[model samples]
Target: MVVYQSNSTNKRSRGFRVRSLSHFAERRVQSQKLPSHEDTYPEPGKSKVTEEKPRETRDEWVISIKDKVNKARGDVTASTWDKLCIYRVPHYLQEDDKKSYFPQTVSLGPYHHGKEHLLPMECHKWRAVNMVLEHTKKGIETYVDAMKNLEETARACYQGPICMSSNEFTEVLFLDGCFVLELFRGTKEGFTEIGYAPNDPVFAMGGLMHSIQRDMVMLENQLPLFVLDKLLELQPDTVYQPGLVAQLAVKFFAQLMPTGEELTKMDKVESVDLVGDNGELHCLDVFHRSLFKSTRTPDGKSLKKSMSSRKQQLIHCVTELKGAGVKFRRKKTDKLWDIEFKKGYLKIPKLLIHDSTKSLFSNLIAFEQCHANSSNDITSYVIFMDNLINSAEDVSYLHHCGIIEHWLGSDFEVADLFNRLCKEVVFDPRDSYLSKLSGEVNRYYSRKWNSLKATLRHKYFNNPWAYFSFSAALVLLILTLVQSFFAVYAYYKPSS
Candidate 1:
């Protein structure tokens, strides 16, 4: 015990040195296990957790939205009290055009039953004998019944005759929905108080009839391909004969006109005619005479007075008609007395041309040429444009209709080409101007490239490699961008 105490300090110092050396060795091993600063901190803000964080998840937000949608569905279902809402499946969407809103009924032929006759073994003989015999037996009776029904319908829909003037010679009336220029044939005694008298006998019925016949003819001549197809479907034999149905339609339409002289005097000549073959009349000629009163420019002394007089007359006429509950309105384009009947307003263009006068023929021809050149089809846009240009009563009318666009300024050709290109890329929607233009351009290109691919494949048998080349080019472009990004980063990177 005495010897151990004497060396206590030295023993303590020896123990401390041994412990310190062992701790040093352990620390060295730990340091070797730990990552270096360069390895752990590649960039200042870089993360060290090798496994990526759950991408700062918005899973709760997504769940909330899903729950909200489910709740809405449940509410709608509950409120309806029906397991399925059948009507929610709309027949027509709002995006659909007006024409599409109406469901098309299946078209039936002349026979009331919707059936077509299939050819039999003895078809030619059966058709020649049986069809002819059947027609001879029933055609006249059927025609008479049809005419009677048509007359009844016309009477039911009658909107009273349009009275042009009180004078018997001047008065023209629209009766049974047909225009008639009457010449007074006779007078009634008691009717004098209501303005019917004897001396003013009517006479223009024949002329009016002639005019209607001409109008019908023009319409038949200008019938579009689609209309022809419909006509053929209704009367296949008539299509081959040509103008037969048109003539019949014109005659039927004429039957809608009033008989007698009082109806004929008011038939003003229209510029354009819709005459049927055999040159039968279909409608009155009124549009031409009323609009073009003179071909010569008015003398300075009378010009203002004439124009003023015309304007007043038109205004007065329209005002009187309006007062009488007529729906006719004086279009803003009118400089003089020009008014259009309102019922079946969409058909006004056709009707007006039917009633158009010879004075407007030149203008109509010009308009037709322009319209044909400008449009691939008789689209509504083209029709509207034609009306604007051809129907304008004066320069003021043209201005009022806002039809300046029809005049292709300096860039007409360019605009036309551009429109064609657009048409090539788009489909037609019939009435839509833009869609029609796009369709026209598409048609042009389609026709231009007809069978080109077939010819190429058959003649050379080479698969097109342009698409592959383009894809390869795109890949190379992406790699170049990545390489550029890395090169820039490397140049800007700090060195230790």
Candidate 2:
């Protein structure tokens, strides 16, 4: 559309084209101005502008959904989903207790590496690598090349994509693996034998070793066992093999065991990890698998096969169990998961609660809950213990029965440890190994005679003072009855 600018007397004199600067100025204004809602350029009905509408809020939503569907489809065939062994702890699990799931003194895997606080350990890690190369008489290339070959496999072990270059990731596996093997060897065979000084900071330092040990077992702070084993094999003439590395691990992490009893039979554990430990993912995995493994004897015979059964959440609290004549005793077994109930007796292997127990159990439970190939044994045990321990009294009773030993401040602290362990976990009650045992305990608890006898014993014979007081009352009542009977007989005879 064109508008003509005309002088007062030039109605048709200049022809319709205004050949002046005013014509150009008018055109610029038309180009710069936007058309109002009422107007459409080049006739509204004649153009496609009528059909072309602006984007609406609903259109954005549709696009977003399409993108999500595309992402979901990619996850279906993504092999990493199944191949993941080392996982970042989900936010829900780690939110409540960051200290339990996170590394403190040292960082092992890529998760916590290079953090501002964890950087001090880097120099120490380099020192460890130097020590490893010096002791094994091999160049760094031997381990570096091995890590590069296993790079893809190592990355696959993690949950998400690793954000490291090939060189960087390989170095991580190489250095971290070497440092871990050295620590394992150092802890067991002495760091002095491994060429470290008597007061070396990491291994020989008293309190620091404990912290490093705790950090080594964290969920996010682990390198793959295959990585460690590959590094182990790369070394020569060392007293290490594919199987004995697990032994070294058990010894390194011996203090993390929940029970103070001779809980781990090193003989039984040596054979189990060959089948299981080669697949043993990380340090946390070694500790987790070693806890529940109680198969094989010195003669190389199978001890007991695992029984598979659906579970029912039937175990009552300790106080309630005691009310039903149920007695608690510490079972003698290396496997902590072995809980047996029979003939009004519920026997559990001794459990020790300490300052480090919470951290260890938290990571183990988190790993079990996150890893797909993992079992619910640890989680089930935690949940079962949480159900059994309702208060300090329950802890005290279990402590008295020799089923629980704790270095914690008090029995209440021990009770709280079990109670808080399973805070944000999801467990199918049917998956608990103790379910059948729990059902039996509940059935026994329902029997009237058992409860009555238990109540009587607990009330009258619970303590020596109570027993003496009840006995005195009973004797006095009997004497009073005898005196009344004599009076009645004498009165009857006098009347006759």
Candidate 3:
């Protein structure tokens, strides 16, 4: 008495009639779409027609196969036409770069999903799924069904074909999605409450958790927002907030953020927020968008660069700028990229350089370069810093100015970090977030008066001893000039 509905207009769904629900087990569809209308019923007394319909002619089979091939090709073409936010780090970009852009401890998406190094985390992933189900009092079927619904669109978000079968893909989505949700909730609420053991290695270990956070923000290792949203909907006893997931993601990675950078936590910006705050492609995208608050856009509204001037070299290094009478001051603001040049002062927000800073920034810059639509603020900032730091002395000068805060043990390491950041990175110096500042800095640097003044300051006014000597010398010279003038007047005017 069981009935299976057929939704496809083609023969695939039309030819199927199941007598029992168990008979439906063998049938599988490549797409996520489910069956619709009920299968046709026979008359009460009619005998079932066991005879098979006439087999299709060879020519008809050939045409049908051709149509399917063409449709698959069309699907691929359309999917590629839509930009996939997640991407492989280009090989050329990886060449000679010492920084590792790939996920090291854990892998979420298919790109690096079963690497030997990442296998250990897989156990925790299963634990996450089990914990989530237990907490919600739901079965594995609920998660599987939820993920299966998003199978096709989620597949489309990746760059190319996922080599896994539909079931495999859905299972991975279920496991990964639950792991992410549970991790976010665990971070917000402790793991013990989330049903993890007190000493659970993945959830409780601080070092592994740090590595996991790093791995999560990588461009290649990302799941789609829709997949996360689907699982978020299934969380029991949770009321939905518009951008709660995004907020959780930001909070999860907030510790890794370089010191003093402000992320606009709003889920939306008025017009320039292209991704909209909550709809970012990945954790890195969320971090990227958070950098857009009150930064240097000419109109104060647009994030787009004006590009009015030709591409110019970066102004000068810290030592060089100091020689050019430019002063370095730390700007007290949350916007990390907000750099300003005025009144002979180059105000840069404080930038903290840690061990993980290079890897984090490298991936973010790579994401910007590979994706056509993404902003290059990070890349531009790195390039800008590269131009301004040629040696350890430059780092020391910036450190003295409160611009660079680092745990790298030495200023030289800080200097080397920026110098190496842009070595193989793709950047247009002219099309930069700091282009306007570069122009202003160079203009100030090129002025003869400023350089001469700086030289005087360095030579005569550099120390208290030098200032005192210069003041005494100036007074002596003035008295000597007065004496000479009086003597000349006495000799010429004869007692007048």
Candidate 4:
């Protein structure tokens, strides 16, 4: 019985091994007969999958990559929203002078938003927002909702991506927008009424107010004009007064204006009606427009002439001009950019330079450089000043002429300020109104006789004593020449 069982087991094992080999052979045959993935899944419209293309050569690969890059760039540009019209301070300008381009007292936009140094102002911002909410009797949610509508548009106003989430960005817009509106109102109304301590450093204090003003006008420290407009529209005051925001803003920045007299004249003539509609980009833009409006005469033809007459040119510095007998005098105009040259006299309007002056000019010049179709008037003025003030003596000369009224300690500081202000500044000197003025000044300077006359006067007639001595010497020389002539005549007369 055992022998029969062992023989049956061996037969079963042999049968199982035979079945496995047959199954494997059948699978191999089936796989060989079946189609490949390419053949099975041919392109829908084609009969067969196309053959794989050959690998590209190195040069071909480079060209293909370049084309893809260019195409991607074009797509990105096309898909991008309208250019923000905001820009970072050029790196070249910031390398040597970072403070002028950066905000110091407060942060307004996302770029410097929540910085450690600027955190102190966050409390003030919140307080300002709260004051606005309380005054308007509107909840913060209203502002948040309104800004939410403007979120995408406001984001596009900045030059680059804002790293915050949409909700965070909207909240920032609400807080900062309210804060700015409330701050501007505070200046109009008292800071104490706007929920600030009487001694609040940023808004109420004396010295710090100037710094905050300087910071608020920085390119990096600007808010979207639409955000400000939205907030302004929601104000109850706008119902009673159409341009309450513009009036408040104009009043707030009145003291800091470059040309206060002109602004006042403009207020009388135009009534601040051009504030929101005149293509102002932000607070600085509003301020800039006020200047433009103020400086122009009522006829508007003067502005046309000023704009058309810009011819970029370079002129001599103060020292060289002095040597060429070019006189420096203060032109009694409220406009800072109005400089004139006539009859060997260079008339620069009185410039009040304070600690904030450098920061102000730097940002204004930077704004001009960053924007398209922007006039380089401010930049050209800065460049012209920089060229004219080469040393402390130049600053002294301007100061003595009443052209420069600086709060700095020394003339050297003022000189250094102007000399360094336009360093790395982007400007087309030939495209500025200053160019025409400079051309005239340089033409006057180039007359060789003017320089010669200056030299002779300086050498022979600079002082009363020098004049007296020169006159005496001339008289003595004439007498000596006459005596010598008489002696020569007597000798040559042959005893006649």
23-121, model 3: which lDDT tens digit per residue? 555354325445443325655776455687879988999999999999999886777435477778887667766346888888887888888988988
lDDT of 2 by residue, 377-426 (tens): 78778889988998999999999998898888999998888878877787
What TM-score fits each model?
Answer: 0.17, 0.77, 0.78, 0.74
Clashing pairs in 4: 312-429, 312-430
Which stretch of 10 consecutive residues in model 3 shows the poorest summed lDDT? 267-276
Q: Which regions of candidate 4 are displaced past 4 Å?
A: 1-83, 193-195, 205-207, 239-247, 255-263, 267-275, 278-280, 292-313, 464-496
lDDT of 4 at 331: 88
In model 1, how large is the Cα lDDT of residue 53? 61
Q: Model 1 RMSD to the real structure?
A: 36.8
* Candidate 3 segments whose C-alpha is farther than 4 A from its true place: 1-76, 261-280, 293-312, 483-496
lDDT of 2 at 361: 94
Candidate 2 Cα RMSD after full superposition onto the native fold (Å): 12.8
lDDT of 2 at 489: 89
Off by over 4 Å in 2: 1-78, 263-280, 294-314, 465-496
Residue 489 local lDDT, model 3: 91
Of 3 and 4, the candidate ahead on lDDT is: 3
TM-score of 4: 0.74
